[model samples]
Target chain A: MRDIHTSAITDAVKKLCMEANWNLEPDMLRAFDRALGRERSAAGKQVLQTLKDNAELARTKRIPYCQDTGMVVCFVELGQDVHVTGGGLYDAINAGVSEGYKEGYLRASIVRSPFDRVNTGDNTPAVIHVDVGPGAEMKIMVMAKGGGCENRSKYKMHTPADAAGAKDFIVECVKTAGPDACPPLVLGVGIGGTFEKSAILSKKALFREIGSPNPDPALDAMEKELLEQANRLGIGPQGYGGDTTAFAIHILTYPCHITSLPVAVTIECHAHRHKEATL
Target chain B: MSVTTANDGIKDLSTPLSDQDVASLKAGDRVRITGVIYTARDAAHGRLAPLIEKGEKLPIDVRGQIIYYTGPSPARPGDVIGAVGPTTASRMDRFTPALLRLGLKGTIGKGYRGDAVKAALREHQAIYFGAIGGAGAVLSRFVKKAEVVAYEDLGTEAIRRLEVENFPAIVLYDCHGGDLYQEGQKVYAREGA
Candidate 1:
């Protein structure tokens, strides 16, 4: 069995949080370059430039990219052969999140209780999802989600006949959201996964690179069709008029109960900051 | 590298901004802004209405000022604030009435406001400028100077006065209640719809 130190996990978590905030990952930058060229509107082009400028400023100044900093979400994959050396593995992960948010100068957006609505001061008790895999290696994925896009998320169960109804609902949601989530945006549509799973899949879909087609032929076609409908809503970049409201629409689907059709749309603004590492 | 100039007062924002000036401004517009603006969002607007009810001393004067609705993150070391970006504007719909009455000239943030806000904008001759929602990096470049003028205890959510030069933004919903999002969509849509 491979011996694992809890402190290692903690330190990695902390450092990862800080690093993610301070720097924009290379892949994200490449995607931005592609977006700059695809955008047709002057305002859309300008927003892309500022986003690039922001990335540069964050790197040179060693500051967090946005003031929201975002709530921490960590996805972990562990090797089944590994055994913990000291302390609880879960606590170690939380510790990493705490230190990273604290030292990194990121915002403390977590709350103690949803009902009370009190800020937890530390962006702690992160949402951690762990999976046990076959090897001796551990992989971690981190994403900082902000309110602008989070607040606009929508999910619904539909009957087969309701498929057409969904187009209008999704379009309306985009229009209502306007430029708030920062356009040109990327839309994540999760189909077939259960209520929460659909939402999770929708978010995970955002990690996919822009312009990458879905592996499933049918799902890819649906994604293209959705993109056509969404941009037609006229919610251009930052809600200012002109084309290029969203950069892409990525969809993930699973088999659902025959009677039900589940769909979840997670809107991601242009900033879309995320990072991952394998240990 | 951008030249720094902060806090020149009302003169800083007097760029003679018009609907046309901002109409074509897509998501990011970086212009050195000089002039006066107001600040009011959800909580402040809520308190202001009650004060207008009781006629007490309001914390801020909204006349001829721009109100930004964001509650930002803490300031990082050697920097002013962390990841500062625009917050949603619909939350303040209830208290917007008092703001128009107080002579507020403009509101800046992401997203559209309710019709009542549009009516208020029309009645008060005000404008709504749309800043990039998550482009805090781009937005912060224009804010050459920032200081917390009120509500220091609120942490990132506290009220502050900022002095900006050539701060970029787009005219989304203007004084005439024109929305750019609608216009842009029409251009990109193909013949089928």
Candidate 2:
């Protein structure tokens, strides 16, 4: 077994947190710039330009790209062939999130109780979804979701009587959402899972990069169709009206109960601030 | 007290902004507004609407002032405010007309307002500027000073008087019923144009 110290893991998590908060991934930059080129609306182009300028100012001044740095979500792939030499691995990851948010000046957006909210101050207790796999190394992906679009995500059970209905429902949600999700959104569609599983899957769908397709042939085309339909809404960037409201639509699907086809849609705004690292 | 950007015909809020000043602005231009701007979101607007319904004196006099729709994060050490960016503007749909009659001059936020607000802006000679949806940190550079002036119980949701400089925003709706968002969308909307 490859023995990893608890402190080493914790240190890695903390550094990853700081880096994710302070830096906008180059891939994200490329996506925005690329989208700008494909964008047809003058208004949409201007919105993208402001985003580009914000990126320049954020990088030069060491400021956060967006104010809502978002709640910390970590997708951890742990290796069964590895052993921890120090404290437990989960503890290390949590500690690192706390330390990173503090040191990086990221806002403490989480609260223990959702109804009667109180600031956690350190942005602690990261929501970690861990999957154990066959390897000697661990991998972590970090995501910070802004609240503007976060409020607009939706999940519903559609009857399997009509196969196309599922896709239709997803398109309506995007149209109603309009420019509210900050436009040029990343659409994560989780299909066929049970209710909560579909929700989680939809969020995980955001982990997919811009313009990537699902592995399934039929579903991949479905993703492409939905992306085109959504852009047609003319809710342009930031809802100002333009040729692009969505840059990509990613679908993640699994088998569900025979009677139900549940679909969840998660919207990621243009400021898609997420990063991945290995331990 | 006059911290400005663009160095143009920027004027104070307490005094009237001329019709010429409002007409000169194009959608994408940037301006740093010095002086007092009030803060309110859905919840705060709810409270203000009822007070206005009774024809009661508002907790704060809002005549000829700019209203920002934001719920900022709590500030940290040596900082005047946190990432205080614009919230979605459509939610204020029902209440803006009454406030417009009460002497409001401008509104700031992300997303577009509906017909009611657009009519109110035209009838009242007011303007609506759309701030960048996600650029809070860069936008924070303009808000040099802030203080809670009302609804202190709302915490970060409280109403504030933010003194800003050269705050950059696109004029989405103007006094003449011109909407940049609508015009821009028509040009870029994905029809077979």
Candidate with top TM-score is 1
Query: Please, what are the lDDT tens digits per residue for candidate 2 over residues A49-102?
Result: 878877776676555677677777788888999898878877888898888877
lDDT of 2 at A275: 81
TM-score, per-candidate, Cα-based? 0.87, 0.84
The CA lDDT of each predicted structure is: 0.70, 0.77
- TM-score between model 2 and native: 0.84
Calculate model 1's interface RMSD in Å: 2.5
lDDT of 1 at A37: 77
Candidate 2 lDDT over residue span B88-120, tens digit each: 888887999999888887788887678888888
Question: Would candidate 1 be rated incorrect, acceptable, medium or high by CAPRI criteria?
Answer: medium
Q: Candidate 2 chain B TM?
A: 0.86
Candidate 2 docking band: acceptable
Return the top candidate by DockQ: 1
Q: Write the per-residue lDDT of candidate 1 for residues B120-153, one digit (tens) a residue.
A: 8777766677667776755665665677766565
